[model samples]
Target: MMQTALQVLDREYLEARCSLVELGAAFDRVDRASDHEENAGEFNDSRLELLKQALGILTEESHLPNRAERLLLLFSDLD
Candidate 1:
C-alpha cells in the first residue's frame, strides 16, 4: 500500500516523538541513580533542558497543542 505524503510525515513525527520519550526516560533513570548522584545533578539538568528545547521545537513545527501538554505531563510525572 502506498502512503500519502501526510501519512509518511505523520509516521515520522510519531517515531520521533517516541524516540524523544525514550531518550527522556533514559535521562530520568540517570537522574535517579544514587551512584552518580553528584555528577547526575548537572548532567540531568542539561539533558532536561535540551529535551525541553527539542520538545518546544517539535511542538512549534507541528503546531500541536497536545504534544506540548504531553511533554509537560511527562516531566510532571517524574516529579
Candidate 2:
C-alpha cells in the first residue's frame, strides 16, 4: 500500500526542509566568499552551470517521474 501525500510529508518534511536550508546556506557561503575576489566568475564555472540546471529540474512542475534520472544524466559524462 502506498502512503498518502500527508503521510509522506509528515515523515520526510523535517529532513527535506533541513536539506533545502543547508543548500541555501552553502550558496550563501559561496556568494560571501566570492565577494572579496576580483575575478570570482562564480557563475561562469561549468560545475555551477550543472548545479543551476539541476535546480531547474527540481523547480519544474510536471507529472514526469524521472527527475532523479534527469539529474543523474545531467551530471554524468556520456562520453
Candidate 3:
C-alpha cells in the first residue's frame, strides 16, 4: 500500500512537471506586460523549488525501505 502510494505520488510529480511549462509561459506573459520580471521570476522560482523538494521527499520515502534492507545485509557479516 505504501509502495502504491509512492508510485501515485511519483506520477503526480511527473504530471506537475508537465504542467509547469504552460504555467511558466503565463508567468512570462505577466512579466512582459507588467514589466515586473523580478516578481514573475521569483514566483516561478519558488514554485520550481517547492516541486523539487516534494519530489525529493517522495523519492526518499519510496527508497527508504530498500535502503534499510540493504544496510542490514551489509552489516550482517559482523553479527
Top-scoring candidate (TM-score) = 2
Tell me how far the alpha carbon of residue 65 in candidate 2 is from the true structure, in angstroms, after superposition: 1.8
**lDDT tens digits by residue: candidate 1, 5-25:** 899888799887898889778
Instruction: Tell me the whole-model lDDT of each prediction, alpha carbons only.
Output: 0.69, 0.86, 0.58
lDDT of 2 by residue, 1-79 (tens): 9999999999999998998899889878778778768877453568877887899998898798889899999999999
Order the numbered candidates by lDDT, best leading.
2, 1, 3
Q: Over the stretch 17-41, how does candidate 3's per-residue lDDT look in tens digits?
A: 8777766786567557556655544
Which one is best on lDDT? Answer: 2
Separate clash counts for every candidate? 0, 0, 0
